[model samples]
Target chain A: MDTALSIGSAICLLLGSFLCLTGGIGILRFPDFYTRMHAVSVSETSAAGMILIGLMLQSPDGIVVIKLVMILLMVLFISPASSHALAQSAMRHGLKPWLSTTVPAIKNKHNETASDITSDKGVPPSNL
Target chain B: MIHTLYLSLTLAAFWLLNSGHYSPLILSLGAISIAFVVYLAHKMDVVDHEAQPVHLTLKLPGYYFWLTQQIILANISVVKHIWLGNKTITPTMTTVKSSQKTDMGKVIYANSITLTPGTIAVDLIGDQIIVHSLLSENIEALKAGEMDRRVRQLEH
Candidate 1:
Protein backbone atom coordinates (compact mmCIF):
# COMPACT_ATOMS: atom_id res chain seq x y z
CA MET A 1 0.00 0.00 0.00
CA ASP A 2 2.76 2.42 0.89
CA THR A 3 4.67 1.67 -2.32
CA ALA A 4 1.54 2.04 -4.41
CA LEU A 5 0.63 5.34 -2.81
CA SER A 6 4.16 6.70 -3.24
CA ILE A 7 4.24 5.69 -6.88
CA GLY A 8 0.90 7.33 -7.53
CA SER A 9 1.92 10.51 -5.76
CA ALA A 10 5.18 10.68 -7.67
CA ILE A 11 3.43 10.21 -10.99
CA CYS A 12 0.93 12.94 -10.20
CA LEU A 13 3.58 15.38 -9.04
CA LEU A 14 5.75 14.71 -12.10
CA LEU A 15 2.81 15.11 -14.44
CA GLY A 16 1.78 18.29 -12.70
CA SER A 17 5.26 19.70 -13.00
CA PHE A 18 5.38 18.80 -16.67
CA LEU A 19 2.06 20.53 -17.22
CA CYS A 20 3.30 23.64 -15.47
CA LEU A 21 6.39 23.63 -17.64
CA THR A 22 4.26 23.36 -20.75
CA GLY A 23 2.17 26.26 -19.56
CA GLY A 24 5.30 28.37 -19.23
CA ILE A 25 6.39 27.40 -22.73
CA GLY A 26 2.90 28.13 -24.00
CA ILE A 27 2.89 31.54 -22.44
CA LEU A 28 6.11 32.36 -24.24
CA ARG A 29 5.29 30.61 -27.53
CA PHE A 30 1.64 31.48 -28.15
CA PRO A 31 1.18 34.38 -30.53
CA ASP A 32 -1.20 36.49 -28.53
CA PHE A 33 -2.74 37.11 -25.11
CA TYR A 34 -5.96 35.13 -25.49
CA THR A 35 -4.28 31.91 -26.50
CA ARG A 36 -1.71 32.29 -23.75
CA MET A 37 -4.53 32.40 -21.25
CA HIS A 38 -5.42 28.89 -22.37
CA ALA A 39 -1.92 27.75 -21.46
CA VAL A 40 -2.10 29.37 -18.06
CA SER A 41 -5.52 27.84 -17.52
CA VAL A 42 -4.03 24.41 -18.18
CA SER A 43 -1.42 24.88 -15.48
CA GLU A 44 -3.84 26.43 -13.03
CA THR A 45 -6.53 23.78 -13.38
CA SER A 46 -5.05 20.36 -14.04
CA ALA A 47 -1.56 21.03 -12.83
CA ALA A 48 -2.71 22.59 -9.61
CA GLY A 49 -5.33 19.92 -9.16
CA MET A 50 -2.84 17.14 -9.79
CA ILE A 51 -0.35 18.56 -7.34
CA LEU A 52 -3.01 19.00 -4.69
CA ILE A 53 -4.40 15.52 -5.17
CA GLY A 54 -0.87 14.14 -5.04
CA LEU A 55 -0.31 15.94 -1.76
CA MET A 56 -3.63 14.72 -0.43
CA LEU A 57 -2.60 11.13 -0.99
CA GLN A 58 0.56 11.58 1.05
CA SER A 59 -1.17 13.41 3.89
CA PRO A 60 -1.89 11.15 6.90
CA ASP A 61 -4.05 13.64 8.68
CA GLY A 62 -7.67 13.93 7.59
CA ILE A 63 -7.58 17.62 8.34
CA VAL A 64 -4.69 18.05 5.93
CA VAL A 65 -6.62 16.27 3.22
CA ILE A 66 -9.59 18.51 3.86
CA LYS A 67 -7.37 21.58 3.72
CA LEU A 68 -5.90 20.43 0.44
CA VAL A 69 -9.40 19.88 -0.91
CA MET A 70 -10.41 23.35 0.20
CA ILE A 71 -7.42 24.79 -1.62
CA LEU A 72 -8.30 22.80 -4.71
CA LEU A 73 -11.89 24.00 -4.57
CA MET A 74 -10.74 27.58 -4.15
CA VAL A 75 -8.43 27.25 -7.15
CA LEU A 76 -11.15 25.62 -9.26
CA PHE A 77 -13.50 28.51 -8.56
CA ILE A 78 -11.11 31.45 -8.63
CA SER A 79 -9.10 30.49 -11.71
CA PRO A 80 -12.13 30.46 -14.00
CA ALA A 81 -13.53 33.66 -12.56
CA SER A 82 -10.25 35.47 -13.06
CA SER A 83 -9.74 34.01 -16.53
CA HIS A 84 -13.23 35.02 -17.63
CA ALA A 85 -12.76 38.52 -16.28
CA LEU A 86 -9.44 38.85 -18.08
CA ALA A 87 -10.81 37.53 -21.35
CA GLN A 88 -13.94 39.65 -21.09
CA SER A 89 -12.02 42.80 -20.35
CA ALA A 90 -9.66 42.12 -23.23
CA MET A 91 -12.59 41.58 -25.58
CA ARG A 92 -14.26 44.75 -24.29
CA HIS A 93 -11.06 46.66 -25.01
CA GLY A 94 -11.12 45.28 -28.56
CA LEU A 95 -8.12 42.98 -28.16
CA LYS A 96 -8.51 40.77 -31.18
CA PRO A 97 -7.67 37.11 -30.80
CA TRP A 98 -5.17 35.64 -33.20
CA LEU A 99 -6.52 33.12 -35.70
CA SER A 100 -4.84 30.79 -38.12
CA THR A 101 -5.52 31.71 -41.72
CA THR A 102 -6.29 28.14 -42.79
CA VAL A 103 -9.52 27.73 -40.84
CA PRO A 104 -12.64 29.35 -42.28
CA ALA A 105 -14.37 32.00 -40.22
CA ILE A 106 -17.20 30.70 -38.08
CA LYS A 107 -20.48 32.57 -38.08
CA ASN A 108 -22.64 32.39 -35.02
CA LYS A 109 -26.44 32.74 -34.71
CA HIS A 110 -26.07 36.50 -34.38
CA ASN A 111 -24.28 36.47 -37.76
CA GLU A 112 -21.33 38.38 -36.30
CA THR A 113 -18.10 37.50 -38.08
CA ALA A 114 -15.21 36.56 -35.78
CA SER A 115 -12.80 36.77 -38.73
CA ASP A 116 -13.45 40.47 -39.00
CA ILE A 117 -11.82 41.09 -35.66
CA THR A 118 -8.89 38.87 -36.51
CA SER A 119 -8.30 40.79 -39.73
CA ASP A 120 -7.23 43.90 -37.87
CA LYS A 121 -3.47 44.53 -38.32
CA GLY A 122 -0.63 45.27 -35.88
CA VAL A 123 -0.23 44.38 -32.19
CA PRO A 124 -2.86 45.16 -29.59
CA PRO A 125 -2.26 48.39 -27.67
CA SER A 126 0.14 47.76 -24.79
CA ASN A 127 -1.65 50.20 -22.48
CA LEU A 128 -4.19 47.52 -21.72
CA MET B 1 -35.00 29.99 6.35
CA ILE B 2 -33.51 26.74 5.12
CA HIS B 3 -30.92 28.67 3.20
CA THR B 4 -29.91 30.54 6.34
CA LEU B 5 -29.61 27.32 8.24
CA TYR B 6 -27.45 25.82 5.52
CA LEU B 7 -25.30 28.93 5.45
CA SER B 8 -24.71 28.77 9.21
CA LEU B 9 -23.91 25.10 9.05
CA THR B 10 -21.44 25.66 6.26
CA LEU B 11 -19.85 28.53 8.12
CA ALA B 12 -19.49 26.46 11.23
CA ALA B 13 -17.86 23.63 9.35
CA PHE B 14 -15.48 26.04 7.69
CA TRP B 15 -14.55 27.54 11.06
CA LEU B 16 -13.97 24.21 12.68
CA LEU B 17 -11.93 22.97 9.78
CA ASN B 18 -9.71 26.00 9.85
CA SER B 19 -9.43 26.35 13.61
CA GLY B 20 -8.48 22.70 14.35
CA HIS B 21 -8.34 23.48 18.05
CA TYR B 22 -11.01 22.08 20.38
CA SER B 23 -10.31 24.18 23.47
CA PRO B 24 -13.46 25.64 25.03
CA LEU B 25 -12.20 29.19 24.58
CA ILE B 26 -11.34 28.68 20.91
CA LEU B 27 -14.60 26.86 20.32
CA SER B 28 -16.57 29.71 21.83
CA LEU B 29 -14.64 32.24 19.80
CA GLY B 30 -15.29 30.31 16.63
CA ALA B 31 -18.99 30.07 17.44
CA ILE B 32 -19.24 33.77 18.15
CA SER B 33 -17.45 34.65 14.92
CA ILE B 34 -19.62 32.33 12.89
CA ALA B 35 -22.81 33.81 14.34
CA PHE B 36 -21.59 37.34 13.75
CA VAL B 37 -20.66 36.52 10.15
CA VAL B 38 -23.96 34.79 9.53
CA TYR B 39 -25.83 37.77 10.96
CA LEU B 40 -23.87 40.13 8.73
CA ALA B 41 -24.59 37.91 5.73
CA HIS B 42 -28.30 37.94 6.58
CA LYS B 43 -28.28 41.69 6.94
CA MET B 44 -26.54 41.97 3.59
CA ASP B 45 -29.38 40.00 1.99
CA VAL B 46 -27.02 37.41 0.54
CA VAL B 47 -28.36 34.47 2.52
CA ASP B 48 -30.75 33.28 -0.15
CA HIS B 49 -30.85 30.27 -2.44
CA GLU B 50 -28.24 31.59 -4.83
CA ALA B 51 -25.87 32.28 -1.97
CA GLN B 52 -26.20 28.95 -0.18
CA PRO B 53 -27.17 26.76 -3.12
CA VAL B 54 -27.91 23.84 -0.83
CA HIS B 55 -29.95 22.43 -3.66
CA LEU B 56 -26.71 21.90 -5.56
CA THR B 57 -24.77 20.36 -2.68
CA LEU B 58 -25.99 16.86 -3.45
CA LYS B 59 -25.72 17.17 -7.24
CA LEU B 60 -22.39 18.96 -7.51
CA PRO B 61 -20.16 16.01 -6.62
CA GLY B 62 -21.36 14.01 -9.62
CA TYR B 63 -21.00 16.98 -11.92
CA TYR B 64 -17.54 17.64 -10.54
CA PHE B 65 -16.47 14.08 -11.17
CA TRP B 66 -17.56 14.36 -14.77
CA LEU B 67 -15.97 17.76 -15.10
CA THR B 68 -12.68 16.48 -13.69
CA GLN B 69 -12.56 13.85 -16.41
CA GLN B 70 -13.21 16.45 -19.06
CA ILE B 71 -10.55 18.72 -17.64
CA ILE B 72 -7.97 15.95 -17.72
CA LEU B 73 -8.79 15.05 -21.29
CA ALA B 74 -8.72 18.67 -22.33
CA ASN B 75 -5.44 19.21 -20.52
CA ILE B 76 -3.80 16.31 -22.35
CA SER B 77 -4.99 17.64 -25.71
CA VAL B 78 -3.75 21.14 -24.94
CA VAL B 79 -0.41 19.79 -23.79
CA LYS B 80 -0.01 17.87 -27.04
CA HIS B 81 -0.85 20.93 -29.09
CA ILE B 82 1.66 22.92 -27.11
CA TRP B 83 4.43 20.44 -27.89
CA LEU B 84 3.42 20.36 -31.56
CA GLY B 85 3.88 24.11 -31.64
CA ASN B 86 1.71 26.89 -33.02
CA LYS B 87 1.65 25.59 -36.58
CA THR B 88 -0.69 22.78 -35.55
CA ILE B 89 -2.98 25.03 -33.49
CA THR B 90 -6.20 26.22 -35.05
CA PRO B 91 -7.20 29.09 -32.85
CA THR B 92 -10.87 29.81 -33.24
CA MET B 93 -13.40 32.03 -31.53
CA THR B 94 -17.06 31.21 -31.91
CA THR B 95 -20.28 31.46 -29.95
CA VAL B 96 -22.02 28.45 -28.46
CA LYS B 97 -25.64 28.41 -27.35
CA SER B 98 -26.25 27.50 -23.73
CA SER B 99 -29.58 25.77 -23.13
CA GLN B 100 -29.78 26.74 -19.51
CA LYS B 101 -32.52 29.17 -18.48
CA THR B 102 -31.36 30.23 -15.08
CA ASP B 103 -28.40 32.51 -14.33
CA MET B 104 -26.74 29.91 -12.10
CA GLY B 105 -27.08 27.29 -14.81
CA LYS B 106 -25.64 29.56 -17.44
CA VAL B 107 -22.80 30.52 -15.13
CA ILE B 108 -22.01 26.86 -14.56
CA TYR B 109 -22.03 26.19 -18.28
CA ALA B 110 -19.77 29.12 -19.00
CA ASN B 111 -17.38 28.27 -16.18
CA SER B 112 -17.17 24.69 -17.40
CA ILE B 113 -16.16 25.96 -20.79
CA THR B 114 -13.55 28.22 -19.27
CA LEU B 115 -12.36 25.50 -16.95
CA THR B 116 -11.39 23.27 -19.83
CA PRO B 117 -7.81 23.91 -20.88
CA GLY B 118 -8.22 24.21 -24.62
CA THR B 119 -11.19 26.56 -24.49
CA ILE B 120 -12.17 29.71 -22.64
CA ALA B 121 -15.54 31.36 -22.31
CA VAL B 122 -14.72 34.91 -23.37
CA ASP B 123 -18.10 36.53 -23.05
CA LEU B 124 -21.65 35.60 -22.17
CA ILE B 125 -24.74 37.40 -23.38
CA GLY B 126 -27.99 35.75 -22.46
CA ASP B 127 -27.82 32.15 -23.71
CA GLN B 128 -24.91 32.77 -26.02
CA ILE B 129 -21.30 32.40 -24.85
CA ILE B 130 -18.36 33.50 -26.93
CA VAL B 131 -15.75 30.76 -26.61
CA HIS B 132 -12.11 30.90 -27.62
CA SER B 133 -10.36 27.65 -28.33
CA LEU B 134 -6.77 26.58 -28.91
CA LEU B 135 -7.98 23.89 -31.29
CA SER B 136 -11.01 24.15 -33.56
CA GLU B 137 -12.05 20.64 -32.52
CA ASN B 138 -12.48 21.84 -28.95
CA ILE B 139 -15.05 24.34 -30.14
CA GLU B 140 -16.68 21.63 -32.23
CA ALA B 141 -16.96 19.34 -29.23
CA LEU B 142 -18.55 22.10 -27.19
CA LYS B 143 -21.01 22.80 -30.01
CA ALA B 144 -22.08 19.16 -29.66
CA GLY B 145 -23.46 20.18 -26.21
CA GLU B 146 -22.59 17.20 -23.99
CA MET B 147 -21.20 19.49 -21.31
CA ASP B 148 -24.13 21.85 -21.65
CA ARG B 149 -26.58 19.00 -21.22
CA ARG B 150 -24.70 17.80 -18.15
CA VAL B 151 -24.79 21.27 -16.60
CA ARG B 152 -28.51 21.56 -17.32
CA GLN B 153 -29.03 18.23 -15.60
CA LEU B 154 -27.03 19.46 -12.63
CA GLU B 155 -29.09 22.62 -12.34
CA HIS B 156 -32.32 20.68 -12.22
Candidate 2:
Protein backbone atom coordinates (compact mmCIF):
# COMPACT_ATOMS: atom_id res chain seq x y z
CA MET A 1 0.00 0.00 0.00
CA ASP A 2 2.79 2.40 0.88
CA THR A 3 4.58 1.59 -2.36
CA ALA A 4 1.43 2.26 -4.41
CA LEU A 5 0.84 5.56 -2.67
CA SER A 6 4.45 6.67 -3.15
CA ILE A 7 4.35 5.70 -6.81
CA GLY A 8 1.17 7.64 -7.42
CA SER A 9 2.61 10.69 -5.70
CA ALA A 10 5.80 10.49 -7.72
CA ILE A 11 3.84 10.28 -10.96
CA CYS A 12 1.69 13.24 -10.02
CA LEU A 13 4.65 15.35 -8.98
CA LEU A 14 6.44 14.59 -12.24
CA LEU A 15 3.39 15.48 -14.30
CA GLY A 16 2.89 18.71 -12.37
CA SER A 17 6.49 19.76 -12.87
CA PHE A 18 6.22 19.00 -16.56
CA LEU A 19 3.09 21.11 -16.93
CA CYS A 20 4.69 24.03 -15.08
CA LEU A 21 7.65 23.85 -17.39
CA THR A 22 5.37 23.85 -20.44
CA GLY A 23 3.56 26.91 -19.07
CA GLY A 24 6.82 28.73 -18.49
CA ILE A 25 7.97 28.08 -22.03
CA GLY A 26 4.61 29.17 -23.33
CA ILE A 27 4.75 32.42 -21.37
CA LEU A 28 8.09 33.19 -22.94
CA ARG A 29 7.06 32.16 -26.47
CA PHE A 30 3.49 33.40 -26.80
CA PRO A 31 2.89 36.61 -28.71
CA ASP A 32 1.34 38.94 -26.13
CA PHE A 33 -0.17 39.51 -22.71
CA TYR A 34 -3.48 37.67 -23.13
CA THR A 35 -1.84 34.54 -24.50
CA ARG A 36 0.71 34.59 -21.72
CA MET A 37 -2.11 34.91 -19.21
CA HIS A 38 -3.78 31.86 -20.74
CA ALA A 39 -0.49 29.94 -20.46
CA VAL A 40 -0.22 30.89 -16.81
CA SER A 41 -3.74 29.61 -16.18
CA VAL A 42 -2.59 26.20 -17.40
CA SER A 43 -0.04 26.19 -14.60
CA GLU A 44 -2.47 27.60 -12.05
CA THR A 45 -5.32 25.14 -12.60
CA SER A 46 -4.12 21.69 -13.63
CA ALA A 47 -0.48 21.90 -12.62
CA ALA A 48 -1.19 23.31 -9.17
CA GLY A 49 -4.08 20.87 -8.72
CA MET A 50 -1.90 17.88 -9.63
CA ILE A 51 0.85 19.00 -7.29
CA LEU A 52 -1.60 19.55 -4.43
CA ILE A 53 -3.32 16.22 -4.95
CA GLY A 54 0.06 14.50 -4.94
CA LEU A 55 0.94 16.19 -1.69
CA MET A 56 -2.41 15.24 -0.21
CA LEU A 57 -1.80 11.60 -1.09
CA GLN A 58 1.61 11.67 0.53
CA SER A 59 0.26 13.19 3.74
CA PRO A 60 -0.11 10.64 6.50
CA ASP A 61 -2.87 12.02 8.74
CA GLY A 62 -6.30 13.63 8.50
CA ILE A 63 -5.18 17.11 9.57
CA VAL A 64 -2.61 17.33 6.83
CA VAL A 65 -5.16 16.08 4.33
CA ILE A 66 -7.64 18.71 5.45
CA LYS A 67 -5.07 21.50 5.10
CA LEU A 68 -4.15 20.32 1.61
CA VAL A 69 -7.80 20.20 0.62
CA MET A 70 -8.32 23.73 1.87
CA ILE A 71 -5.38 24.95 -0.18
CA LEU A 72 -6.69 23.16 -3.26
CA LEU A 73 -10.13 24.69 -2.84
CA MET A 74 -8.68 28.18 -2.55
CA VAL A 75 -6.64 27.72 -5.71
CA LEU A 76 -9.54 26.31 -7.70
CA PHE A 77 -11.98 29.01 -6.68
CA ILE A 78 -9.89 32.18 -6.46
CA SER A 79 -7.48 31.87 -9.36
CA PRO A 80 -10.07 31.97 -12.15
CA ALA A 81 -11.82 35.00 -10.70
CA SER A 82 -8.58 36.96 -10.56
CA SER A 83 -7.70 35.95 -14.12
CA HIS A 84 -11.07 37.07 -15.42
CA ALA A 85 -10.73 40.40 -13.65
CA LEU A 86 -7.31 40.94 -15.15
CA ALA A 87 -8.53 40.20 -18.66
CA GLN A 88 -11.54 42.45 -18.23
CA SER A 89 -9.45 45.35 -17.01
CA ALA A 90 -7.03 44.94 -19.91
CA MET A 91 -9.88 44.91 -22.42
CA ARG A 92 -11.42 47.99 -20.82
CA HIS A 93 -8.13 49.81 -21.46
CA GLY A 94 -8.61 49.62 -25.28
CA LEU A 95 -6.11 46.85 -25.85
CA LYS A 96 -7.58 45.06 -28.85
CA PRO A 97 -6.54 41.47 -29.53
CA TRP A 98 -4.70 40.07 -32.51
CA LEU A 99 -7.38 38.33 -34.55
CA SER A 100 -6.99 35.93 -37.43
CA THR A 101 -7.00 36.94 -41.14
CA THR A 102 -10.41 35.37 -41.67
CA VAL A 103 -12.24 38.10 -39.70
CA PRO A 104 -10.74 40.82 -41.86
CA ALA A 105 -11.14 38.77 -45.02
CA ILE A 106 -14.84 38.30 -44.45
CA LYS A 107 -15.27 42.00 -43.79
CA ASN A 108 -13.33 42.94 -46.92
CA LYS A 109 -15.35 40.51 -49.04
CA HIS A 110 -18.58 42.11 -47.87
CA ASN A 111 -17.24 45.74 -47.79
CA GLU A 112 -20.11 46.60 -45.42
CA THR A 113 -18.72 45.41 -42.07
CA ALA A 114 -15.43 47.29 -42.42
CA SER A 115 -14.12 48.02 -38.97
CA ASP A 116 -11.74 50.64 -37.58
CA ILE A 117 -10.18 47.94 -35.41
CA THR A 118 -6.93 47.28 -37.27
CA SER A 119 -5.39 43.77 -37.30
CA ASP A 120 -2.02 44.21 -39.00
CA LYS A 121 0.36 44.68 -36.09
CA GLY A 122 0.76 41.38 -34.31
CA VAL A 123 1.31 42.62 -30.72
CA PRO A 124 1.78 45.96 -29.06
CA PRO A 125 5.39 47.04 -28.73
CA SER A 126 5.45 47.40 -24.94
CA ASN A 127 2.97 48.06 -22.18
CA LEU A 128 5.35 49.21 -19.52
CA MET B 1 -31.35 32.38 10.45
CA ILE B 2 -30.43 29.10 8.75
CA HIS B 3 -27.61 30.80 6.84
CA THR B 4 -26.21 32.21 10.06
CA LEU B 5 -26.40 28.85 11.79
CA TYR B 6 -24.72 27.09 8.89
CA LEU B 7 -22.02 29.73 8.74
CA SER B 8 -21.38 29.43 12.47
CA LEU B 9 -21.23 25.63 12.23
CA THR B 10 -18.78 25.82 9.39
CA LEU B 11 -16.63 28.33 11.27
CA ALA B 12 -16.64 26.14 14.38
CA ALA B 13 -15.57 23.13 12.37
CA PHE B 14 -12.80 25.06 10.74
CA TRP B 15 -11.65 26.29 14.13
CA LEU B 16 -11.66 22.85 15.65
CA LEU B 17 -9.81 21.29 12.76
CA ASN B 18 -7.23 24.06 12.80
CA SER B 19 -6.74 23.91 16.57
CA GLY B 20 -5.57 20.52 17.79
CA HIS B 21 -6.40 21.38 21.40
CA TYR B 22 -9.68 20.48 23.13
CA SER B 23 -9.08 21.99 26.59
CA PRO B 24 -11.72 24.18 28.25
CA LEU B 25 -9.94 27.52 27.85
CA ILE B 26 -9.03 27.00 24.17
CA LEU B 27 -12.51 25.67 23.35
CA SER B 28 -14.19 28.68 24.89
CA LEU B 29 -11.90 31.03 23.02
CA GLY B 30 -12.74 29.31 19.75
CA ALA B 31 -16.45 29.55 20.48
CA ILE B 32 -16.16 33.24 21.34
CA SER B 33 -14.32 34.00 18.12
CA ILE B 34 -16.88 32.10 16.05
CA ALA B 35 -19.69 34.00 17.73
CA PHE B 36 -18.03 37.34 17.01
CA VAL B 37 -17.62 36.43 13.34
CA VAL B 38 -21.22 35.34 13.03
CA TYR B 39 -22.36 38.58 14.63
CA LEU B 40 -20.31 40.59 12.13
CA ALA B 41 -21.62 38.60 9.20
CA HIS B 42 -25.20 39.17 10.33
CA LYS B 43 -24.60 42.91 10.69
CA MET B 44 -23.03 43.09 7.23
CA ASP B 45 -26.14 41.48 5.73
CA VAL B 46 -24.12 39.00 3.64
CA VAL B 47 -25.62 35.75 4.83
CA ASP B 48 -27.49 34.54 1.78
CA HIS B 49 -27.68 31.46 -0.41
CA GLU B 50 -24.84 32.56 -2.64
CA ALA B 51 -22.71 33.49 0.32
CA GLN B 52 -23.34 30.19 2.10
CA PRO B 53 -24.49 27.82 -0.59
CA VAL B 54 -25.31 24.72 1.47
CA HIS B 55 -27.50 23.51 -1.35
CA LEU B 56 -24.52 23.10 -3.69
CA THR B 57 -22.81 20.70 -1.32
CA LEU B 58 -24.32 17.71 -3.08
CA LYS B 59 -24.03 18.97 -6.65
CA LEU B 60 -20.47 20.31 -6.60
CA PRO B 61 -18.66 16.97 -6.54
CA GLY B 62 -20.13 15.80 -9.83
CA TYR B 63 -19.61 19.19 -11.45
CA TYR B 64 -16.00 19.26 -10.27
CA PHE B 65 -15.39 15.79 -11.72
CA TRP B 66 -16.60 16.93 -15.13
CA LEU B 67 -14.59 20.16 -14.86
CA THR B 68 -11.44 18.17 -14.04
CA GLN B 69 -11.77 16.19 -17.25
CA GLN B 70 -12.25 19.39 -19.23
CA ILE B 71 -9.16 20.88 -17.60
CA ILE B 72 -7.04 17.87 -18.57
CA LEU B 73 -8.19 17.99 -22.18
CA ALA B 74 -7.57 21.74 -22.30
CA ASN B 75 -4.07 21.34 -20.91
CA ILE B 76 -3.27 18.84 -23.63
CA SER B 77 -4.55 21.18 -26.34
CA VAL B 78 -2.64 24.17 -24.93
CA VAL B 79 0.61 22.24 -24.49
CA LYS B 80 0.37 21.11 -28.10
CA HIS B 81 -0.06 24.68 -29.33
CA ILE B 82 2.81 25.90 -27.14
CA TRP B 83 5.15 23.34 -28.71
CA LEU B 84 4.03 23.79 -32.33
CA GLY B 85 5.60 27.29 -32.59
CA ASN B 86 4.05 30.70 -33.22
CA LYS B 87 3.36 30.27 -36.94
CA THR B 88 0.22 28.40 -35.90
CA ILE B 89 -0.91 31.18 -33.56
CA THR B 90 -4.33 32.81 -33.94
CA PRO B 91 -5.75 34.89 -31.10
CA THR B 92 -9.31 36.09 -31.55
CA MET B 93 -11.73 38.10 -29.43
CA THR B 94 -15.46 37.58 -29.79
CA THR B 95 -18.72 37.73 -27.85
CA VAL B 96 -20.87 34.72 -27.01
CA LYS B 97 -24.32 34.46 -25.44
CA SER B 98 -25.06 32.81 -22.09
CA SER B 99 -28.39 31.35 -20.96
CA GLN B 100 -28.06 31.24 -17.20
CA LYS B 101 -30.78 32.81 -15.04
CA THR B 102 -29.11 34.06 -11.86
CA ASP B 103 -26.10 36.20 -11.07
CA MET B 104 -24.34 33.21 -9.54
CA GLY B 105 -24.97 31.14 -12.65
CA LYS B 106 -23.61 33.80 -14.97
CA VAL B 107 -20.54 34.24 -12.80
CA ILE B 108 -19.99 30.47 -12.82
CA TYR B 109 -20.37 30.32 -16.58
CA ALA B 110 -17.88 33.14 -17.11
CA ASN B 111 -15.39 31.71 -14.64
CA SER B 112 -15.60 28.31 -16.31
CA ILE B 113 -14.74 29.94 -19.61
CA THR B 114 -11.70 31.61 -18.04
CA LEU B 115 -10.71 28.39 -16.27
CA THR B 116 -10.36 26.55 -19.54
CA PRO B 117 -6.86 26.79 -21.05
CA GLY B 118 -7.31 28.74 -24.26
CA THR B 119 -10.34 30.91 -23.53
CA ILE B 120 -10.59 34.01 -21.30
CA ALA B 121 -13.85 35.74 -20.49
CA VAL B 122 -13.10 39.45 -20.76
CA ASP B 123 -16.38 41.21 -20.14
CA LEU B 124 -19.94 40.19 -19.36
CA ILE B 125 -22.88 42.34 -20.47
CA GLY B 126 -26.16 40.71 -19.55
CA ASP B 127 -26.07 37.30 -21.31
CA GLN B 128 -23.23 38.13 -23.68
CA ILE B 129 -19.55 37.58 -22.77
CA ILE B 130 -16.50 38.97 -24.52
CA VAL B 131 -14.01 36.12 -24.77
CA HIS B 132 -10.47 35.94 -26.03
CA SER B 133 -9.07 32.63 -27.25
CA LEU B 134 -5.66 31.36 -28.29
CA LEU B 135 -7.27 29.03 -30.81
CA SER B 136 -10.34 29.41 -32.99
CA GLU B 137 -11.40 25.88 -32.11
CA ASN B 138 -11.98 26.88 -28.50
CA ILE B 139 -14.08 29.86 -29.56
CA GLU B 140 -16.10 27.71 -31.93
CA ALA B 141 -16.90 25.34 -29.08
CA LEU B 142 -17.97 28.19 -26.79
CA LYS B 143 -20.13 29.68 -29.51
CA ALA B 144 -21.84 26.30 -29.94
CA GLY B 145 -23.21 26.54 -26.33
CA GLU B 146 -22.31 22.97 -25.27
CA MET B 147 -20.60 24.25 -22.15
CA ASP B 148 -23.43 26.69 -21.57
CA ARG B 149 -25.98 23.86 -21.58
CA ARG B 150 -23.98 21.82 -19.10
CA VAL B 151 -23.52 24.76 -16.73
CA ARG B 152 -27.21 25.67 -16.98
CA GLN B 153 -28.08 22.13 -15.97
CA LEU B 154 -25.69 22.33 -13.06
CA GLU B 155 -27.23 25.61 -11.88
CA HIS B 156 -30.76 24.32 -12.22
Best by lDDT: 1
TM values, all candidates:
0.93, 0.90
- Cα lDDT computed for each candidate against the true fold: 0.87, 0.82
Q: Write model 1 residue lDDT over B35-106, tens digit each, in one string.
A: 899889989999887888888999999998999899989999999988898788888888899999899999
Give the alpha carbon lDDT tens digit for every residue of A1-128 in model 1: 99999999999999888989999999988888988999999899988988998999899889999999999999999999999999999988877887776667564456344446655533443533
* Per-prediction fnat: 0.81, 0.66
Clashes of 1: 0
Interface RMSD against the true structure, candidate 2:
2.4
Candidate 2 lDDT tens digits, A1-128: 99999999999999999999999998998877888888999999989988998998899899998888888888988988999889878766766666666443223222211232344434444552
Q: Which CAPRI tier for candidate 1? A: medium
Q: What is the lDDT, from 0 to 100, of the residue B80 in candidate 2?
A: 89
Tens-digit lDDT string for candidate 2 (B15-79) = 98878889999999999999999989989989999999887778878887888888889889998
Which 10 consecutive residues of model 2 chain B have the lowest summed lDDT? Answer: B86-95
- Model 2 sits at a Cα RMSD from the real structure of 3.5
